[model samples]
Target: MTTLRIILGDQLSTTISSLHDIDKHNDLILMCEVNEEAQYVKHHKKKIAFIFSAMRHFAEGLKKKKYNLLYTKLTDKENTGSFKGEVKKTIRQHHINHIIITHPGEHRVLEDIQSWETDLNVSLEIREDNRFICSTDEFTKWVKNRKQPRMEHFYRHMRKQKTVLMDDDKPIGGKWNYDTDNRKPPKSNLTIPKPCSQKPDQITKEVISLVNEKFKDHLGELDGFDLAITRDQALKALENFLSKRMPSFGDYQDAMLEGEPWMYHSHISTYLNAGLLLPMECVKAAEDAYLNGSAPMNAAEGFIRQILGWREYIRGIYWLKMPGYADMNFFNATRPLPSFYWTAKTDMNCLKQSISETKKNAYAHHIQRLMILGNFALLTGIDPKQVSEWFLIVYTDAYEWVELPNVYGMALFADGGYLASKPYAAGGSYINKMSNYCKNCEYNVKKKTGADACPFNYLYWNFLAKNKKKLEKNHRLAMMYSTYERMDEKTKKQIKNDSLQFLENLT
Candidate 1:
């Protein structure tokens, strides 16, 4: 007469309300590690290690609280390599009549869970996932009667609703967003305080060894995998960020320095994404720092936007237009992902820094992913599927629900401007203005129409010119494309030739 409650690895919040009403005497918790998730995208070795280790820890914690737990290890002999198979076997063995689960993050997994209802006699009850600040129902309600869905408007609404960065029904500092102040370039000879690093203990090291042996050919290295695997450790990482890093996190969040990987970034995305830490707690910590005058308003506001604004917004977009969202390709791009992407051997200093850091740590800050590597892929028309696959495999915090909208819509503009207002397409000048990579590059950032010229120069203009018919109707891009049409034919041809040759070498 036991009811089984299934908890996915990402749903590890100790304070989950779904567990509140559970009768521990008659209910049991089931957590499993299936091969389908691990092999889906060749996940980073550290990412796999992080999840397995965290799940093991969570299961142990639940056991101490006198809760009946059925934990399935990945290397278990009975493992069927799929969630459906595992659930079916468990149901038969336990003779469970009712199955309760919190909502899954990905649309595919949600559908798979739904399929189980008719196949078994068990009543499947799904509780809403309340980890995010904005509920799916609330977001849908906000957009139920809207024509154009802009993130800015949505972000403002969130700010007011959450009472974050607001002052008595008005935005603080007379501005709702401090993003303009947050985009300053890195200062010369800046003394960046070294961030804290965690050393793997026995449990974490064992998980790392398993990942190395099992996922040997994955995208990232396992040597430097020092992420938090328990809630206590996650709190330490969060405290270290607010005290040592958050003060400068806003000023240089977008700035990329040579050979400096952690430049004022919190580096806590791995912990938050893995469910070891909750978003509300993280947001509260930032707010506390600001109220105490330990961190500036700009810094606190910027960090909150990343969490409550972009993070929540992307999740909403994924659920709103999914099931067929992964196949979007507005550009019809056919180019292979550049070979240099796999190896950090590019002449472009920006790409080199971004790629090399990602290879070592399996992470890069938001700007590095969006501006350098992502911008290059979008401008060159590399297949969005290929780019999205790379993103899914290479990051420590990559879950399809989060990675898809960010890469396919925001990065590649493959969804025809659904998640973004317009393409974040830009030439090398933007990179040069924002970073010091341009100073150390072999190609000339200023040159526009030759082999010696920076590829971004031609590719940026060519992307606009080639996709003009597709993008001309966008009001934000009208003036930009109008100028392209009036340009002399000879100039346009030379730019196109340069872009073509660079793309040829890129593949």
Candidate 2:
């Protein structure tokens, strides 16, 4: 009985679970570049190129191992556009009676895979993706009968379970989080370490050319496609980050610079999400940096929390609450996302820098994503689904499992309070504090109303005032409501009028 083993683009790791017990002679490994997956969201040109190139590189490695592999390039004449169609054709051609695949990362793909058994009339075995530290079953058990699934509580549990940053039974440095120390704003003269970039190999160059020709009208540019497409390059990137950038990573983890897109941030998310670098390896690298005194305890601890804590927590939350989670619109935010999000044609320097960087590189640090683009979307009341889709389309590192929780829950607060305790709504002042974009902005940061004032300043108050009944009861936002109530009627009226006028002219 021949078995067909399917591998998705994100499952590029040779150590992936589905490949564990493969029979080299009888089993055929199937990897395809399906249009259904690539064009599902009009993904960034760079993103498409990266995934395709990485998959091609990985397939070549499998070929060297003498495995029976059925690889379909996108431009191939007989290529089917969907995974199910391709699998059906492959099964019939190879006379296969059994199929095995790792569970897909996104809920949509998982739902589609669930129907494959009946459609193909074969014994389909969907194996668990064991790359993550916490399994879906484990996450579900942790959240069972819980009123609120707080990330910090989950993070603490993971710390104990994994012994990450642990000294015997307690956390090192006498603290679980170094977030307070990690929020220092960028200084104008700070020397930032640049992230390592890999020049494209022959395979990657061909993939880039293909993406340019096919996805010519896609969101981002492919001029400087320097991402690491192979496992060795990914390991080099991780080494560069730990040795050179980890020292200052925590100090300016939340800081942003106008033209500096990387700013001490590890650019390994693309590699990690693509399965080039395993999560445990990254966690251990940071811990090793701390133990060897190559990096500060705060820096190492903060970096570890992101991968071991926030990254894993978000994934667990995603798997635990999908299908219905994407439909959530807790605040009923219905305003359409503005054109500036696409065109980057705005006077707001922060938005311009962040969006432009995304369009050019398909990358932006977490702060730029959360505080700049996400904050604007939240304050302006853009539809959570629209914003979430925009995020999924534009970022190279975006996949629905990671992107949805971040946008729908943390960014827009669309899940009400499931992922985050408070809405991350903020004004221009917060941007000014964290970034240098305000120095070149057209609007005055000090002004709170009228033309020439930062739009965020007035819109922030407008959002609170408009959503008062819905948000005022939250203890986290009680202080802001009290402050708003103390404001004179004339000031409140000016804020409302200016905000409405600004929003009216947004398009």
Q: Give the top-scoring candidate (TM-score).
A: 2
As a TM-score, model 1 comes out at 0.97
TM-score of each: 0.97, 0.99
- Deviation from native of the Cα of residue 445 in model 2, angstroms: 0.4
lDDT tens digits by residue: candidate 1, 1-507: 678898898888877655768898888888999889888878878788889988888888999998989988888999998888888888999888888898898887999999999987678988888788888999898878777777878888998998887787898778878888898989878888776677888878888888888889987777767787888988998999999999999999889888888899998887887777888788888988998899998899899888988888888888888868899999998799987888989898899989999988888888899999899999998998899889988888888889999999899999898778899998998898878898889999999778778888889999998998899899999888888889899989999998888877777
CA-only RMSD, every prediction: 1.5, 0.8
Q: RMSD in Å for candidate 2, one decimal?
A: 0.8
Candidate 1 residue pairs in clash (backbone atoms < 3 Å): none
- Model 1, poorest ten-residue lDDT window? 11-20
Model 2: how far residue 37 lies from native, Å? 0.9
